[model samples]
Target: MSETILLVGHGSRAANGNREIEQFVQSWRERQPAWRIEVCFIEFAEPLLDAGLTRAAQDARRVIVVPLILNAAGHAKMEIPAHIAAARLRHPATEFVYARHLGAVEPVLHILERTLRRAMLALDAPDPKTTGVILLGRGSSDRVANGEVAKMARWLHEETSHELVDIAFTGITHPRLETVVQRHSRIGMTQVVVLPYYLFTGTLIERIQRQIAHLRQQYPLLRFGLGGHFGFEEEIFGLLDERVRAARADGTARAEHMMECDGCKYRGLAEPHESHHHDHAHTHAREVPA
Candidate 1:
């Protein structure tokens, strides 16, 4: 039986952003040339998810749709599966597998913590332990997804020596960066570190930088620093490869740990929805080297 890998990215309007994902997939192909690999986007880029699935089913018996997202947000839960269900209709003979979203897993946590320590060292901060850290994410309307970020904050606090770790969003959620900055400053945290929990640069990161800049200007007494983003580095490929392997074993993209629901948020149900849009509105605000 022939095997195939479908790298589904959250398509961005910016060609560069789309290109970044393509390059990432290209690297994967280089490492493992045996499997037939295909890349597609959910929106804002050519070779959309439906098209990718159609193409993958042409020759392979098992097609693994690895969603290139950070959290178990709307896209992962709703949109990706909806597309898969549609593809199954077109090619009922083909088998489609879904995998889990790339959250703050153990490997990522290690990278994130290392990045924070580097940022603080670059700033020549007096006490890295006392500095407050903020894990900033593309805030989701789904409470479950938002809760994931909050949970990551607690994990980071335990994994690192930061005095206080917090969660903030770029949009569509409470406790935005500004609100947190004020609360932390008033509470007498001399230094604050904001880590952008993202794989690629987008408008949300730009918005975060601007918000942090303004906060720095407002509170000159306190130090504000931004950490490096989680780009399409070597570790990203490792994580996706692991997911693809798991999908191959389970015969589906839906992972065991992910919440189970169909025709819910990703497909836009009236009630009990689990996803929100913004996958395609990825404007270039930050750039990570390929």
Candidate 2:
């Protein structure tokens, strides 16, 4: 039985937001020719999680659900699991595994780095070594979620040659974008750029753009540019593949260990059908090329 991957995103009310997820899934499918992949929305979109999972599980024994969300908030923690539970109740025979969200992974950071570098080039900034980057993320009420953004900034500062790196948010917490721009202006960092660490265009992106426009006018001496969001990166597919494999390995290990110890009810989930075992192994054979 082939393994299927259902890439789920926080479906937006906006049409373009839905298209963005489909486009990303198409790109990911190209890189993963052997594995069966599909895109689904959690809400406010057609072909919801139940429909998507049922279709993918038609011929597959194992399915992995990958959340394209940034943080493990209410949606990621409660809403998503509830949907998965509904799907399992409908198709109890099929095995299901859930992967972590696409947070500040290395590939995401690489995409951010490339986006910032392009923005700097557009501004004709002479030296990246002397440039400072303000990495902006959609702030969250959860402290852990907010820390993820700060951690990404620190990672970029240490990994790249940029002179300084700081994180700011558009909502939910400080330092707000306006305050960060003002602070940088006070320090005389005229070559500062704001990079939006978002996956797609939305109300937040529009608000950030307005803020950048105002900042440019307020601080005429400081150079500012809005970097594009993460879109259509080949590395993103590789990251998805890695996440699937890691989740499968973890699930398999847990199943096997439980069988040996407690003779758990889910022990049968580990035993593969004789005819399906070979196909299952083949499904995981195609790895993203280094």
Candidate 3:
């Protein structure tokens, strides 16, 4: 039976950011040539998610929509599924399954480590003991999503001996990227590593560069290193492949590596108004289904 893998990304207004997603998709096509692959966006870009789903349904018997999202906020939890649910009605004969977001995978913890390590290495291998860490996430109005980033920062702190690890948001929530990066720089730490907990780069990353630029001027002596986003990594592909297999086997929107609901403070914690947060595009991958 013909099958297609529809990779969905949050669309971006930035041309370069959108291009990177295409490049990412290209890599998948190069790696696996047997399966049909398609790319789509949720907003602000061409070939929106619905279009991709419709196109995939036309030629493939089985269609799997994999969201390249880094966090499980409204987009992942509510929007994407809503889109899939609607698409299912139009393509009732097509077998459709949705896979988990990237952050759900535990191995991504290592991706975070690796991202920070690169920044550390670039800064002359600063002693982890003396280095302060700031992990930036594309923040959400949903406190639950924001909390996941905090959890990641905590995990990073445990994995390494970094005495200070803080989480900051690029858009919403408390302690913006600038506030955390600047505060950490002024502290006693010899170095500060600003790492992004993102699937790929986008407008927000450019915004981060502005923050890094300003920090560089204020504290020239402090080793301020910025790390790249997780892009085209082998582990990423492996995890996505695993999700595809799991979803295909079960023929359901398999929420693999889903966050545990118990012990989740954000589930019941009071949060600010949801209107405070904004959204942006992120994601990548290319391939033909195997």
Top candidate, metric lDDT: 3
Clashing pairs in 1: 74-275, 78-266, 79-266, 97-252, 97-253, 98-252, 98-253, 98-254, 99-253
Per residue, candidate 3 scores C-alpha lDDT tens digits across 1-290 of 88999888887777777788889888888877886878998877889878888997897788888887777666765566667767879988988777766664578888888888888889889799889999888877666667788888999999998999999877756788778767776778888899877776677777788888988887887778898888677878777777677777766633422434443323433235432111112221111110
- Reference-based TM-score of each model: 0.85, 0.80, 0.85
The sequence of per-residue lDDT tens digits that candidate 1 reaches over residues 127-214 is 8566889888777766666777787888889887777899988776778888888888888888988998887755555666788788
Each model's RMSD to truth, in Å? 5.7, 9.5, 7.0
* Ranked by lDDT, top first: 3, 1, 2
Ten-residue stretch with the least lDDT total in model 3: 281-290
lDDT of each: 0.74, 0.70, 0.74
Give model 2's TM-score versus the native structure.
Answer: 0.80
Total backbone collisions for each predicted model: 9, 0, 9
Off by over 4 Å in 1: 253-257, 260-290
lDDT of 2 at 47: 85
Residue 289, model 1: lDDT of 18
Cand. 3 TM to true fold = 0.85
Per-residue lDDT of model 2, residues 123-158, tens digit only: 896576556689987776555566778888988888
What is the lDDT for 231 in model 2?
57
